[model samples]
Target: MIVHIIKKEIHFRIIKKLCVCFQLLLIVSCQTDDDNPTLPVEDSINGFWFSEELGYILEFTEGNDVVYNINTAGCSIVDDDFELEDFVPSLVSANDLILTTDLNESDFEFTRLSNQNPTCLPDQIADTDDPKVNFDHFWNIFNDYYAFFETRNVDWSQYESLRDQVTTDNFYDILEELVLLLEDGHVSIFDEENGIQIDSGFPKLLETFNMNLSGDFIIENGDDLGDLFGQKATTIVTEYLGGDFEIDERDNILWGLINDTVGYVNVLTMAGYGSDFSNELSTLNDLLDTIMNDISASGVSKLIIDIRFNGGGHDTAALDIVSRFMDQERFLYTKKFRLGNTFTEKRAVSVGPKGDFQFTGDIVLLTSPASISAADLFALCMKDLPYVTIVGENTAGAFSNVLSHTLPNGAEIGLSNEVYEDPQGVIFEAVGIGPDNQENRVPFLSTLDFEEGIDSGINRALELFSN
Candidate 1:
C-alpha cells in the first residue's frame, strides 16, 4: 500500500520576515487508533539529523515532536522546540525520509541516523547569559561558518585565549575588536541593551584617501562644482529630470547634463528608497526610469554613474539599476554557499532590461573604497557590460549576502556566509574590482574640495567622452 504524506501549512509572509534561516524539517504525527490509521511501512525517521552547514541538530522523537538546537560552539546550544502535527512522511529509501512542509512549498530529505542520540547535544552551555559564554558563542559562529578567514588573514584560534579575560564590563569592547579584525564592511556586532554596535569599516577606509565621499559631503559640495568646472559644467536642479518618486534632494540622488552632451547621476545610497526590499526596488526602478528617460531624451552621448560613497543596500536594487542600461539579458554573477568544508554549486545571477527606456551610450562607473556591498556588486555587474568603464579607486570589497544571527545573550551578529563570483569564476571579496583606466584618480572625499575642485576620476571619464 502506498502512503501519502500531508504537510502542515506555513505562511510565507511570516517565513520571509523571520531572521532565522529556513532549514526547517516537517514531521508527521504518529497516528494510532479507534478507527485504525495507516502508517508507513518503515519507521526509520526517529533519529538524530545534523546539518553542519547551519550548525543545527534535529532530534526526531517517538511522539512525533522535533527538538531543534542551534549549536554555535561545542558547549553552547540555543533550543527552539516545536511540535509537528498533521503531516505525513514517506520513506524514500531505507535510511532517507522525505519531509514536506505545507503552504511554504518546501521539502527536505533527512537521512536517518544509526545512533539514537548524539554526544554533542548533552552539553547545552548551561549559563548562556554569562559574558564568557556569549563571547565564545560569537567567536565559534565565525570560526565555523565564516568563509573568509584566510582571505581576511584572521587568527581565529587565538581568540580562545581571550575568552577567560572577557568580562561583562569589557565584553562589548573585546567583541568589537574581534569583529573589526575581519575588516569587512558587512561584518557587525550589535548589543542594543549594552548600547554597542560596530561601525562599518568602509568609512575608516575612506579616511586613507584624505577625503569624505558621504552623501552629506556630496550635497554640501555639489552646488559649488559648477564654479570649479567653469564653462565645462552646469548644475541643473534635480526636479528638471522629472520623476514622481520622492527622494531626499540632499542625499539620495543628484542628476544633470554635463557639457550639454554627458549625463551624470550620483547615487548616494541604495537604502531609503522605500520601507521594505520590494518597495525599495520599485522606488529605485521608478527613479531610474525618470532619470534615464530624461538623459536618453536629451540625446546625451555619454553617461556617468557615480557610486563613489554609496554604502549599498539590496542586491535586487543593484540589478534593477543596471538593468536600465542593458538592452538585452546579461549574465551578471553567481552565488554559492559553503557546505561542510567545500562550497556548493554556483548559482547564476542575471539581469535583463527593465521598463521602456534603456541607456545605450558610453557609461562610466565611478568607485571608491567607500563603494561597498551592493555598490561593489553593482560595479561587478556593470563591468561585464561593454559600454561601462569603471573609474576611481577600487571598491570596498565586502560582497556577500549578510546573514544575521542572534546569540543567547541577546547580542546580534551579522556575517557573510555566501561567496559571490563573476562569470569568469573570479571572487572579489577582499580585492575590489579594478578600474579600466586609472587616470586622474582623486581621493573619494577630495571631490568635496571645490578649491582644488578637481576629480581625477571624473576628469578621466570626461576625457574618454571627449575623445
Candidate 2:
C-alpha cells in the first residue's frame, strides 16, 4: 500500500549509439496520445530486461518481438496473442502494454514491453517499449488459467509491482503477501536458489519455535515444565536402577540410569547422522533392548521417550521402537492417500525379539508441533500401541513426501511423491498426528498462553501418569 524508491548509480559503457537512438525515436513515435485516451492504440516497447535468476540482461528487438526467453534456452517469438474487450477497462488505470488475439469469440490479454518500467504505478501510463510486457502478459494469463485469484486481499496491481522489485531483502514480506493471496495451505514459496530459502511449512514455522533439553534438571530454573517431566522420569528410572544413572554426554543419550525400573532413551531427531543421513536402526535396537531389560528385571510400570523437533529420518528406526511395545508380529494402524483414488497399506510388524516381546506397561511420549516426517512416522505407528499415549499439539502434517522443482521463470512448485499410511491403511497425508492427550499453552505463567488450563496436552499426560 506504501511505496518508496531509493536510487543507486552504476557505471557501464555505451555502444551502438545509432541503433539505441533510433529505437528511442520509434518508441516516442508510438506515443500518439497522452490525453483523450479512448480506443486502444498501437504501442512500442523495446529495451533490456534483467532478472536476478537469469543473472543477465535480455535484449528485445523492435520487430518480431519475443514474449518469452527462458534463461537456459534463450528467447522465442510470440506465436499467438489474445484481446480482451471488456477487460481493457480493468487495466486502463495500470501502466501496462496490451496484446491480444480472438479465439472462440473470447478475448485474452498480453503486453508488449519496450522501454517502460516493470513496476506498475497507480495511475501512471506505461511506456511503449518495455521487455516486462511479456512477463506481465504471462502473469495475467496464468492467474486466469489457474483461477487462484483469491490468494490474498492485496491489490493485484500492487502485487505485480512488488514482484518486479524482488531484489530487496523485504522479499520475504513480499512472498508472505503473495502466499496470503493464494489462500491455500499447500502452496508456499521456496526461493533457495535466490538465497531466500523458505521451509516446507514456513507459514506455520513463522509462528513457532523449536526447543531442546537445556541445562541440568532444576526446579528453580524458570518453571520450565519440560525440565519437570525429565526430572520425574529420571527419579523413577533411578529408583529402579539402585545405582545412580549417568547422562551420556558423548552422544547426549541419557543412559546408565534405568536399572530395571524403566527404559529411558533420548531421540534427538528422526533423521540420523553422516553424509548419507540415515537413521541408525542398530542404535535404536540397543536402546529398546535396554528398556526391555529394565521392564523384565524390575517390573517397570511405564516407559517414556521424548520427541521434540524430530524432522523424521529412517523408517526402520520407527519399526524398531514400536516393535518393543507390541505383542504381535503384525498390526494395523493407518492408511495413506495417493493420486487417482488409490490408497496404500501399511503394516507394523516386529522383526526383532519374536514371541511375547510386547511391553504391557504404560507407554508415554513427549512431542511438539515441530515433530514431523519420520517422527510423525513414530507417533502414528504407536497411536494404537498398548497403553501408549502422546503429549503435544498435532504435528506439522507436512507428510506425503513431496518433490519440488523450479519453473523456467524461477517459480518453485512442490508435488507429493510418496504416500505414508498407518498399518490399517489410513494415510495421514494432510492430517497431522494429533496427540492422544492434547497440550495447550500454560497460563498465569504468563509465559505460556493457553486456550485452556495449563498446557492441556502435557497436563493430561501427567494426569494419566499420576493415575
TM-scores of the candidates in the order shown: 0.70, 0.47
TM-score leader: 1
State residue 19's C-alpha deviation in candidate 2, in Å: 55
Give the clashing residue pairs of candidate 1, or none.
28-87, 211-445, 212-445, 440-456
List, residue by residue over 76-174, the lDDT tens digit for candidate 2: 221112122122221232343322211000111223234533332113322222324323433332232221232223344445665476544454565
By lDDT, the best candidate is 1
- TM match of model 1 to true structure: 0.70
Candidate 2 local lDDT, residue 304:
58
